[model samples]
Target: MTHQTADATDHPTVAALVARSNRLGGDPRNTNYAGGNTSAKGTAPDPVTGQDIELLWVKGSGGDLGTLQPKGLAVLRLDRMRALADVYPGLDREDEMVAAFDYCLHGKGGAAPSIDTAMHGLVDAPHVDHLHPDSGIALATAADGEALTREIFGDQVVWVPWRRPGFQLGLDIAAIKAKNPQAIGCILGGHGITAWGDTSEECEERSLDIIRRAEDFIVSRAASRDAHPFGPQRPGYEPLPDDERRARAAALAPVIRGLASFDAPQVGHFTDSSVVLDFLARERLLPLAELGTSCPDHFLRTKVKPLVVDVPTSATVEETVTALRAAHAAYRADYAAYYERGAAAARARGEEPPAMRGADPTIVLVPGVGMFSYGRNKQTARVAGEFYVNAINVMRGAETISTYAPIAEDEKFRIEYWALEEAKLQRMPAPKPLAMRVALVTGAASGIGKAIATRLAAEGACVVVADLDLAKATAAAAELGSADVAIGIAMDVSSEAAVQAGLREAVLAFGGVDLVVNNAGLSLSRSLFETTEADWDLQHNVMAKGSFLVSREAARVLVDQGLGGDIVYISSKNSVFAGPNNIAYSATKADQAHQVRLLAAELGEHGIRVNGVNPDGVVRGSGIFASGWGANRAAVYGVPEEKLGEFYAQRTLLKREVLPENVAAAVFALCSSDFSHTTGLHVPVDAGVAAAFLR
Candidate 1:
C-alpha cells in the first residue's frame, strides 16, 4: 500500500480525502451513523525538532465522516504509531492500547482519535479509506467468504479473519499487508473492507471498484437463476395484496408504537418506508431477515436480529396485534437465552463477560405487513431503518449468489456487548423530558403559542403548528425546525369539523397525540353597554368553545390509544380578575378556566391531565393587540398605546415584562413529569401579579 509522489500537494490530497469521505458518509448503503473512517498521510514539520515527520490524518472519534472537518482528523505520528506493533504483543487491556495511541499523538491536535487509528496507520498507502459497504459486507460475512474473495478478487485483496478490533487486530492487519505487499487492500472478515493508494481519488476508486465487483457478482447470479422475484417462498403460500398489507400496517401502527415506548416519559416513533414494505413482502421473510447484521459495524445500531412478528394468513387486525404482543414476550425470552450463550462463551475464553443490553428490539419485521424501526428519537429510528434496508440488500445479494450466511450469533454478541462500542452508546446525550412526544400548539404562528411551541420543541417534542392562518403556521413550523421536528396545519378551532380534522392530521403525522395547547384566541374589547351579540359570540366561539373542541378531540385520540397525555388551555389573567372594557374577553376566559376544572375531573380517570396557563401583559406582537384591543385598553388607562408594553412591565411585582416565553415555560412545566401527579392547576406567568394569583 506504500506510495510516494513528488507532485502530490497537501492541499489537493486533503481536499480529495475529505470529499471522498463525505460522499461515502452521506450514503447509508456505504456507511451509517459514524461507522466508517478515512485517512491520508502527509509529512509535517515536528514542532520541537523542526524535522519533517510523516503524520497520518485520520477521522476522529464521535464525529460523522460525512460532515468531517479538517480538525475532525486527528494527526498522529505514523512512525510512532506503527512502532506500537511491538508493544501490542504484550498488552491485554483496551486502556493500555488507548495509552499507546495517545503517546503516538504528533501535536496538540485535541481531537480524540478513532480506535481504528492504529489500523489505518498500518495500511501501507498514503491515502486510505475503510468502508462497510453493504455489498462488501455481504460477501465478507458469508460462510464461504474467503473462497468467494479469492474467486472474485483473485490475488488483488488480502483476506484476514475476524479479530476483535484493538491492538491485536491492527497488528494482524499489518502482518497480512506485509505478507501481501502488492495487494491493493485487505478484506476483514465479519467486518469491512479497506482500500489504499497514493491519491485519495485512486483509493476511493479502488474501494468503489471492489464494491461494484461484489454487486455485479450478485446481479449476475440472480439473473442467471432468476426464478422468483420474491425470493424462495413457503410451500403453497401466496403473499397478500399490497393494499391489504398496507391496511394491516396502518391498523397495527399505534399498537407497535405503544410496544416500542417505555412506561416512563420516553416514547419511540415508528416508520414503514417503501423499502421496509418491500422487504416484508419477500418470501421466507423470517429466516432471511433473521440472518443478523450484514457486518459487525451494524450491531451497535440494529442489534443481532430483528424481532419477527408472525402474522398468520387470514388474520384480522385485532388478531395481528394480539400475536404481536405475544411475539414481543417470546422475543424478550429469546434475547435472554442469546445473552446467556454469549456470556458463557466469553467466560470459557477467559474474557470478561459483558453486561446484557436492553431486550427491546430496535428493528421489527412483521410478515404480511411491514417493518418497524423503534428508537427513542426519530433520527436514531431513521438510522435503524436505513441500516435495516442495507441489511436486506446485502442479504438478498448474498442469497442470490449462494446460501446466505452472516457471522455466527456468538460473533454478533461479541460486537454488540463490546466495551468500546458500549461506551459509544453510553455517550449519547440524555434525552429531554418531552423527547419524541408529539404536541399540537394552536395559534403557534405567533405570540405565546409560538413561544410554547418553540420551548416544547427544544425539550425534544415534535410540535404541530396549528393556526387559522395556514401560511403563518407553515412558516412558523419551518422557523422552529425541520419538518420532522415541527409541522404546521390550518385549524379554525371554532369549527367542530375543522378541529376534528386537524386533530386527525396531527395523529396521522405523529402516530398519536400526547399533548395539546389550546392557545388560539382573540380579544373583543367592546364594553357590555356597547358590545353587540356578534362580539360576545366571536370571543366565546374561539376561546371557550374552541378550547372544548380541541380538548375533546385530542382527548379522544389520547384515551383511545390508552396513553396518558396532557392538555393545556391558554386562559388569561382576566379569568381571575376582570378589568375595565374587557367584558367579552374576561367572561369567555373565565368560562374556559371553569371548563378546564370540569374536564380535568372527567379526564383524570383516563390519565389525561388538563391544565391552564394564565398570562398577562404579553403585549408584544399579541394577536389581541393586533386586533385593536391594545389601543382601547391604553385609552382606558389614559396611557398612549406606544407606552403599553412598558406600563405593563412596571406594574408586575417583579417589574419584569411577562413575555410569551415566560408563559411557555410555565406550560412546559405543567406538561412535563414535574407535574405528572399534579393536574387541574392554573399556573400564572405574569411575574407575580397579586390580583392574578390563584386562590
Candidate 2:
C-alpha cells in the first residue's frame, strides 16, 4: 500500500476515521462490541512550535467504537511516539512502554491511550484498523490458519503467528508490513485480523473485504462437510418452547446468580437467542465449552470457560437446581487448580503473577434453558453474554473449516492475569452503595414509591417499578434510567397470582431480587361505626395482605439466591398512634408493622432482613392523600383541606412537614449497609412525632 500525504485539514481525517469506526462497530458481524480500535494519521499545527506536525488519533481506552466521539480519541505526536522504538526494552518489559505513551501525548490527549496505541502509531500507515470480527477470528483460531490465510486471499493477506499484544506485537506487525508491501492485511494467529490502507475509506473496505472472504470460505467448506460442526443435537438437549424456557430461566436465574456471586454480588443476564440455544443443544457443547473461548476479548468477559449443567430439559426445576449446586462446587475447585498451575508457570519463569481473579465462572449454560452471564452490573453482564455468543460463532466457523485451535492454556492465564489488565480494574471508579443489587418497589409509579425508586436508581441499583397501571410504571422507569438500570411492570398486590407474575418479570429483567419495598397501599379515613366490612377488607388486602404476599413471593427468590437481602415495609406512624376516623387504615398499618417483625424473626436464619419505615401525614405529592384521604382527614380534624399538612406538622415535636422524599430517604437507609445488622427496626419519618415513637 502506497503512503498517502497527510491531509491539510486534520479535522476531516479524524471525522472520517470516526465514521468508519462507527460503521464497522455498529454491525455485530464486523466486530464484537468495544473489541476493536481505529486510527488515522494527519498533520496538525503544534501549539508550541507553530509548525505542522504529524499526529495519530485513535480510539481511547474503555470506549466503544460504535459510539466513539471526537472527545474519545487520544491524539499523540507521531514523531514522539515513533521515537520510543529506539529505547524500547525487550518484550519482557513491554508493559512499561504503555506508561511511556503519556509522554508522547499531544495537548490534553483526550481520553487515556490504550495499549494498542503502539500498534496504531508504529504501523506506518495513514489509516489502520484492528478488529475481532467472528469470521476473522474463526480463521485466526483455525488449526491451519497460516495455510488457510494463503489459500483464502493468496498472497494478498499474510499470517502473523501468536504473540501477546504489546509494543513487541506492534513492532512485529510493522516489520511484516514493510517486508510485504503488496500485502493488504494479515490474519493475527489465535486472535483476529489487522488491515491498513493509504486512506480511511480504503482501510475500512479492506477490513470488510477480509471479513466477508473469511466468512465465505468457512461457509463454502461447511457446505461440503457431512456432519454439523457442533455434531448432532443430543436426544434430550433440545431447547424448550419459548414460554417454557423463559419460565424455567426465571426460576433458575436466582440460583445460578447466587452461586456466581460467591466471591462478590453479581447482576445477571439471561439469553435464549438462537445462537445460544443451538450451541447448548449440540452434543459437542460440553467439550467445546470446556476448551474455552479463543479471543482475548471473549474470555476476559465470559471468563476462561463456562459452566455447563448436565441436567436434561425434562428434569424438574427442583432437581435441576440441586444439580446446579453440585456442579458449581466442582467448577470452583477446578478453577482454583487452574489458577495454581498458571501461578506456578509464572514462578518458573522468574515472574511474580498477579493475584488470581474471582474463581466463580461468569457464564452458565443449561441445555434446556439458555445462557446466563453474570457481572458486577447489568450492562457488563449483558455484554458478557453477547461476547460469548460471538465466541460461539467463532467456534462454529472454525470447526467447520478446520479444527478449532485456541492459544495454549498458559497463554490464556497470562493474559487473564496481566498486570496491565489488573491496573485497568483498579482504575475503575468505586461502585455506588447499591451497586449490583436489584430492587422491586410496588406502587413505584407515584408518590413515596416513585421517590424510593428514583433514589435507588441513583445509588446504582437496577430498579423495577411495579404499579397497577402499566403506563405509569413504564413512564416512571423511563425517568429513572435505561432498561439496563431500571424497568417497569404491572402488579396488583391484592392478587397473589399478580404478585408472583410481577416478581417473575423482575427476576427476568435483572437476575434476582436483592431488595423488596412493600409500599403499595390505600387509605380510607373513617370512624369504626362508619367503616364498612368492604372498606376494611380493601385496606387490609392492599396493605397488610399485600405486604405479606409480596414478602412471601420475594423471599423465595432471596433465599434461593443465598445472598442476604433486605425487605422494607412502608408502614405509617398511625400504626403506633391512634388517630380518630382512621380505624381501617391504622389497623392495616399496624398489621404491616407486626408482619415486619415476624418476617424478620422467621427469615433471619436465611440472612434476609425485614425492616419498616413509619412516615406520618405525607400530604403533598402523595397518591393516598390525593385520592380524597386528605379532605376526609381534614374534615375529621376540623381543619381545611389546604391546611391539613400544616395541622399534622404543628402537632409534631419538630413542627416540620414530612414529605415523600423523607420517607424515601428512610427506606434507603434501611436497605443500606448502615442498617445491615439492624433488622425488625422501624425508623420514623414523622418529624419527631413523640406519639409514634417505638415503645
**Residue 458 of model 1, lDDT score:** 95
Candidate with the greatest lDDT versus the true structure? 2
Candidate 2 stretches greater than 4 Å from native: 1-10
Q: What are the per-model C-alpha RMSD values against the true structure?
A: 4.2, 3.0
Model 1 Cα displacement at 409 (Å)?
1.3
Top candidate (TM-score): 2
Q: Estimate each model's TM-score.
A: 0.89, 0.97
For candidate 2, report its TM-score.
0.97
Candidate 2, residues 1-695, lDDT tens digits: the string is 23322322247887798899999999999998889899999887776666778899999998898988888889898999999999998887889999999999987788899988999999989999999999999999999999999999998899999998899989999999999999889999989999999999999999999999999999899889999999999998899998899999999999999999999899999899999999999999999999999888999999999999998899999999999999999999999999999999989988898887788989999997999999999999999999999999999999999989998899999889988889999999999999999999999999999999999999999999999999999999999989999999999999999999999899988899999999999888988999999999999999999999999999999999999899999999999999899999999999999999999999999999999999998999899899999999999999999999999999999999998899889988999999889999988999988878899
lDDT by residue (tens digit), candidate 1, 106-144: 666547777788778886778887788887877877778
| Worst-scoring 10-residue span by lDDT in model 2 | 1-10
lDDT, residue 423, candidate 2: 93
Candidate 1's displacement at residue 543, Å, is: 3.5
Model 2 per-residue lDDT at 288? 93
What lDDT is reached at residue 598 by model 1? 97
